[model samples]
Target: MNVFLGFLYVLKIILSSVASIFLMIAIYLLKKLDVFHINLRMLIMHALLCIFVNNIIQMLRFAISLSQNIKCSSHNQFPAPFCAFLCINGVFICMERLYATFNFSKYENENFSYFLAKIYAVLWMILTLCSLLKFWEGILPGRYNNSLNCELQMIRENPLKTQWHLILTLLFFW
Candidate 1:
């Protein structure tokens, strides 16, 4: 019974991952064209790209980890560095846009100064480097419960830190 259920669980993960990948690709395709040649919020675009790629990687890691022939629960630890960075990057993008929108004088110079745009690009590049530091500090999914249809529980060393980090970054968007 457990084996049958485990098979079903793996199937679900595969299906969901595929669906997510498709959705991400579709979104990318839809945005292939732009109204403006120069975009000020390029950081948001880079962040979104990171997120889409990271999600696919994370999903693949999860499915592979779960499908490993072992019946025991808790097999994977995808650090998902890019995924973690997405939260903070989201806030940064919001803040950058807000600042640019509010202080248009600096960015709207007739000389093609584009100070804000330059800052946005440089900031994302730096943040991308910084995000690499925690590429291996992602979620730890523990034991799959049969009753929960193979749902795994989170087993974290610092749940508070994770929770607070998410909450704090989210606050910036609001």
Candidate 2:
């Protein structure tokens, strides 16, 4: 059992590493092509970049857990904000598409400035950070009260709350 589990873990690490490498290559190619100069493409690239970074973080956390014989659950909190931002980015992408759809004439003729996209990305990051802090407060009261180890269980303990949270999050993202 232990050997099988270790094999599965190693397999996961290999797959994650391969995916990250592919993302890096894709990002490099996109950069070389200057795709980021376009507003929508810039936002798409940001999402890819975030995924790549999140993957790297997960891999590093896994490696650390293996090396130190520590459980990976303790590292869960670190990626929450990344996940939140990715969700928010998806919302921004949709909003951009909707705007383009509504203003097809101007959107097609005008070379939209990347400045606005950059500003939106930065603003979303700030808002996500603030909302995530509040979200944690709601999900796990006394988050800083030496209860870090059990924080994740709070979500699992309340199925209805979790479901509602997911529904609300999806609605907000949409």
Best by lDDT: 2
Candidate 2 ranges beyond 4 A from true positions: 33-37, 120-174
Candidate 1, residue 59: how far the Cα is off, in Å? 2.4
What lDDT would each prediction earn against the true structure? 0.50, 0.61
Single out the weakest 10-residue window by summed lDDT for candidate 1. Answer: 146-155
Give per-residue CA lDDT, model 1, range 51-163, as digits (tens).
Answer: 56555655554455466643443323223344355665676566656866897787554232266457556755765665454334323344433323222333245555435
Model 1 Cα RMSD, 1 decimal? 6.2
Q: TM-scores for all candidates? A: 0.52, 0.64
TM-score of 2: 0.64
